[model samples]
Target chain A: MSIHTLEVLVENEPGVLARVSGLFARRAYNIDTLVVGPTSNPEVSKMVIQVNLEGHSLEQVIAQLDKLISVISIEELVEGAKKPVKDTQPDYQN
Target chain B: MATTHVPTANGTVMNGATSLVKSLEAAHVDVMFGLPGGAILPAYDPIFDSTIRHILVRHEQGAGHAATGYAQVTGRAGVCIATSGPGATNLVTPLMDAGMDSVPLVAITGQVPSAAIGTDAFQEADIRGITMPFTKHNFLVTKADDIPRAIAEAFHIATSGRPGPVLVDIAKDALQTQTTFNWPAKIELAGYNPKIVPDNQSISDAAALIAQSKKPVFYVGGGVIKANAHKELAQLVELLGAPVVTTLMARGAFPDSHPLHLGMPGMHGTVAAVTALQKADLLITLGARFDDRVTGKLSTFAVNAKVIHADIDPAEINKNKFADVPVIGDLRETITALIPALKSALAKNSQDLAPWNASMQKLKSTYPLGYTLPDDGSLSPQAVIERIGKISGTETIFTAGVGQHQMWASQFISYEHPRTWLNSGGAGTMGYGVPAAMGAKVGAPDSTVWAIDGDGCFQMTNQELVTCALNNIPIKVAIINNESLGMVRQWQTLFYEGRYSNTSLESKRVPNFPMLAEAMGCVGLSCERPEDLDATIEKAMSINDQPVVVDFRVHRDAMVWPMVAAGTSNDEIMIARATAPDWDSQEL
Candidate 1:
């Protein structure tokens, strides 16, 4: 599988991220990299997620992300980029 | 659009169109579902000219539920507007439902002008404070200028973090003030920063632990679904060769078809998944709060595993079961770091779990999900759900209320796609199906939605039927009526001293739903005979103009199986009825 970066824009409000994250959690989707911060628009924020997914499922992720009420937009930045699966694994260090 | 000044007992006040419309537009409101009343007439004028669409609702509850339905399906903040007193109070049920389900909603209520606040004047109530605990944040717009900012902030707060409903109370006077309109560009809420980021050190430490473990498993929850991290989760699972067992809310986070997918592991979880969790060496929990339903008897849950809990909410960690490694940050960030950590840590004393995997495989085959079809020609509810799944396809959304129906749905319905099945998981709220189904249908107008509810749950918020009829929203309501609160009855029959009380609705004379539906301007179908089930459901599904409620008169004594008796472990589930003639014919 190839690594892809997903930049999601969401409404800045309560439980928005939780709902978004919960979607991925229940699906057992792991994040290779994730970066979240304020956007140029104060009413919105951006989340940068990196993962390895194939064709149809990648489209599925985009469709699901768009369904979230807080999510404004979703962009697939880097796709079909091969990264060593063993080299880049999701870590929970917070 | 001009304000009309009026003299009140306490002070001077004004009511006008420009003030109310300006604030709504400033708040970026695109639509509102409500009815107009004397107390809210000033605000109605602006709504007519503004770009925002105003949907006239038959009942205040419908306005609230419709907003909830819209918000839940769109994932956008939902807005509902209503007048004071009964209008405002009518919204309470839907608001509470939204709050309980964590749906982002901004509810606007009109009050008598500031001079008459809390004096019990015709349409006056202290709605702001009354709804404070139920919302993430709330505001009372006393000044016209404050109205714009309040609306803007309401949207921001309602949609941010762990999303929930927010109320904005505007007096009729506030809707009359005219000022140079400038919407606030930014919000600054002191001590409330909803953003989350991962700490690098914690990431490194978690990576080290993963590298050290020989047998590791992932315990996922609803948070992954919220973050849209299914691909990342799949990547990690494949990379680490880890098996994942999701909680109820976490359903569909992992592809059910994936080999490493252990399915839901909890009170009602599959036997293999639960057994695997019990013997796992390392537990990597993501986004899920380990609630009692999933943990079963906590002492025996994942007893052999060392836990690494990663959740956005810090309070969730160690709230129940203690974790050896705690990662409190955005789940997306934590997973990004964990991917590399686990990859590098591979090849550290791997244990051969082929035997264990084989044993789990055997358990799955031994206690497979099963139900009996009566030879006497009785229709099985499980079969009905399976039929719906087959005809509707995986993408068609299924919304359910709490009870035996929910369990049966979860068991029989195959959810291949994410977010296609919406149910009350954390708070198993009854009366959730009809409203949530209404909301889901509103969100995805293209898809056919089903409100698969039990008779007990349907009665709780059946008032939404009028909402469905008025809006012309066509949704199917499949009521699995066993003439009793089936779950409670099951418990009473098995262990509650065999004394069933108040569980039977038969004595009350089940509502004449067919007559009620016709009165409410919708088609209604009822079937007491088992043979009529399939054809009736097909008839209900074909209707496209208004909501359809099908009351399935099921056997009262029928009970959901594979039940973990009170105080029993997940291993000791009742797969079938005790009095069944044969074990094979009894349960699967």
Candidate 2:
């Protein structure tokens, strides 16, 4: 099984973390490392979850993660690749 | 700069409880099943003035199952309410059942004040934490102003995509506090959109596979019913002329009386359906997860088939088995797209599948569903169910409690329309039949609803019959009184040297079911002899003013046949214990 790192952007709401972790536990998939923190926007939280799964199973896990109501966006981070810098400013001003 | 004092246009303020009621009204929720308690008293205070109808259930579990039944029949998200601690804890079973079956339901619970939330206060429990694993989503609302938005989002999430239960926990303080009332609050959830459109490539791939295969089978499930795609599914089935096998959750998705229908396929499924799946080369699964019950000994199940799995939930596509073509979208949309593509592909080839169709028809007649009449003059549960199927025809909806009787009803009864069958297929909850029947009656109102229950199962939650009686809902209940846990006893006899441990419920020790029904203001009847069953069933059907209960004392030794023992290959199915060659020496 290959280990993959996924970065997920989610709404800052109660039980959102439990929901993300619960999805993995229900499928009996193991999470190697999980880190959660606030994003540049106070309303959003970012989670970096690392898990070991086969190529096909990992695709299913990612699709399920994308299906969560609290999750905003998900991106797969390449191993040993540099993390992207956070952008603090909005692209368009109201 | 934003001002702190925001005044309402009408210069009126209401408590969170009133806002909650108004929010429910805005969401078009008219009925709710619940039991109130200490933490939830504030919410119930507003119910007196609201238009929402509340049916006070005997237990919290009944409320949950009733909500599920209502949701399944109405095609809308059902609403259920309960208080904190034990009340919220009791709803766990129904929530899990809805999650597994993908029924749309919303559960509202009252919580302790925000201060007492973590202090182990009286009648306080972390319901949001408890239901997080099973629910589609959950909310813990501590502010009065968040009431309307939370309620709206709860309904939206519960009814959207692959629908399941969602929970919203309201702190008591929030309900007591006054805030400006909002009738139509904006839903601010940004991450909860469900995909409805199917990928063009996947649909084309599935169409091509269907057009080319000679031995193709359409395996359908509850998703079709949930999506209300039965018409589209029927169109596809007719277009291809492929034999269809509906799973337990999909009993009514395809009309059982149709010529190409092969019935249910599982552990207790018919031999024709099971054998056909084993021989099929192309299996088109619509909204059906490859559940263990349907696929015995997974490695050897559908061994010759290449699967094309389509479902709204992406997670279900490859969770249990590999899918050569995985189409993720609504069943209605996916089927609608694949139909034209398949028609065009068939026009070019026009391959003959008559040989396969003839073979399946031969199998159907060779091993038709059958049971022998006992000469001892006792009622057979199978015969009872078959008689009910004949009398009810296609008009009545049948809900069953899990066991041998459940399997018998599935085999004997023919469902002609969608949402005509409701059972705890995934959770296998014993007491699901009574409350579900009550909920189905409430939802349909015009249709006849029957609860086919077992003696052991009837004892679990028969108190719901009181709810039916009090509410003036006329649901008929048929309890197949076998005097023992027949399914477990059959297993013990077959696998455990007939130990019969704790499975027997002697009639002497148990309360008389007919008497209990009469005491609860219902028309109660009982049948002991085989000749009395027809008359008793007719009598029960005649009483349409109130709930009726008929207890049929069936033979304890009668077992469900065409059984594939757990964890064994489907090919090793036992047609009948007496008929098997070398039955005395062969290991099960």
Candidate 3:
């Protein structure tokens, strides 16, 4: 098993967070770490989800998440990019 | 001069309730099923003068299942409405049921005012949160302005590729506020794009596999029915002259009378079908996921088979069994493309399937589906179902509750057309037959619809008889009354040493099914002797003004045979309690 991170952009609305997180649980996909924050356009939210899976499961999860109405686009970040300097991670000051 | 006809959806300024009604009208909604309560009261105000006919159901669950039934048969988005909290929560079962079976349904529920959402207000429940995992998509409309768009999107998402349930929960305040209604030019779903065309390479690869393999089986599922692709599927099946095994959800996808049809596969499936899958070398699976029930002991399931899986949903292709040649596209399109490709591939290499056909014929002749009469002399439930289907003929639509009756209905009924056989397959929910049958009758007013239910399943939603009686649905219900939870009791007899515990519902006359039917304003008839069975069913068929119920008190000892015990390999299938069919392949 290896680590993979999916950057999903979704509409900022009621139950948007629940829709994304609940999808993972429903499909029985386990998440190692998840971080959500507002984009420059306050109307859109970005969620970074990291999961440990092997074979085509990561591809399957992305395909499933893409079916949701709230989701706009999904991008897979490079594997090693996950461990940026500890302080360079997204800050929740706002 | 030519006129460009863009459908006009502009509407005058109105409250969200009227907006909701007008939006549904703009969507060309013919009928809806629902119940009204506190938070949903405003949405009901505009129904008095609306063109949409709303069937007032007895319960919210009934409304949900009724909508599901309507969607399954009609291939349209079924609409159901309910209030907040208890009403919304009650819809949980049918939502998940429709999700599993891939029915297109739109559920509209009212929520407490926006201000009271998280304050634990009376009649407040987070229904969107509860149903997210099951429904295909959902919307929580916090503003009245969002009503039209949300409703339009809900219908679009529900009926599109890989159709499933979608929910829209609007706040009461939103329904009371004023807004202008206008349908969007196009749905604004960015991430939702379903690929319909198959890649040429994939199609050619699948076609070559089919041409080269000696033993091939088309494992069809409900998607064939949903996509309206049975014609293409039948073409492919006949071209190869190979065996076909339709899953329970796909009973009518292929003609049951076809020369090469081997009935349904999985637990309680026919011996011929189970054996075809076990010994096959190529499985040309279409629109079917390798479900656990269908794949008894997956490791041993089709040990020699290589799957050529095709589905609209990519996630399903390799979720359970690995697909050697995965064709990710709509089944209708995929099959259409593969037909020509197969013809070309066969020009180069044509493998003879005579050896495989010999094996299938041996299994079919040796282990035909038949049940001996129970010692108690009560009517055999299987015989009762066959008689019901035989009398009703191929034109009629049949629905069943889950249990022995469901299995019997699948096995005995001669389904000739798509959508003729409707039942809860993936999610085996009891109490689904009556309401779904009622919905089917409403959708097809001229067609005869029958709900073959078991004694255990009938009592759960039998109250819906009042809905049918009050309306002019005129549905026929055949209660396979065994006076016990027949399926469970059968398992207890086999696995639990015949120690029947809490299995018997006790006192056949306690509820008095006939009396209950009469009280519900239906013609209640009971038949105990097999001699009177035909006449009683014929008598029930004669009535065309009101719903009729015939309680066939069957032998309690009857069990579904040609069985594969839970988690056991298909090789261990039992034709009877202790009898196993010896296959010709066993000698090979």
**Candidate 3: deviation at residue B160, Å?**
0.5
Q: B416-508, model 1: which lDDT tens digit per residue?
A: 665677777766778778877876777788888988888898888777777778777788888887778888888888877768988988712
Candidate 1 lDDT, A22-70, residue by residue in tens? 6676556667877889988787888888878875455456544543545
Q: Which candidate is the best by TM-score?
A: 3
Task: Give me the TM-scores for chain A across all models, comma-separated.
Answer: 0.77, 0.82, 0.81
Interface RMSD of 1: 14.1
lDDT of 3 by residue, B1-588 (tens): 111122354667889998888878866789999999999899899987898999999998889888988888899999999999999999999999999999999999999999999999998999999999889998899888998888888888888778999999999999999887766666756667666777888899999999989999999999999989999999998788899999999989999999799889999999989989988999999999999999999999998999999888866867789888988787899999999999999989999988888778777776778889988777889999999999989999999999989999999999999998989999999999999999888888889999999888898998889999998889999999888888899889889999999979752777888889999999999999999999999999999899999989888888899899989998899988987876544532
On DockQ, the stronger of 1 and 2 is 2
**DockQ-sorted candidate list, best first:** 2, 3, 1
Residue ranges of candidate 1 with Cα displaced over 4 Å: A1-94, B1-29, B35-41, B118-125, B297-300, B347-356, B507-509, B528-532, B565-572, B577-588
lDDT of each: 0.71, 0.86, 0.87
> Which 10-residue span in candidate 3 chain B carries the lowest summed lDDT?
B1-10
Give per-residue lDDT, candidate 2, residue B505. Answer: 90
TM-score of each: 0.77, 0.94, 0.95
Best model per DockQ: 2
Between the candidate structures 2 and 3, which one is better when assessed by lDDT? Answer: 3
| Docking class for candidate 3 | acceptable
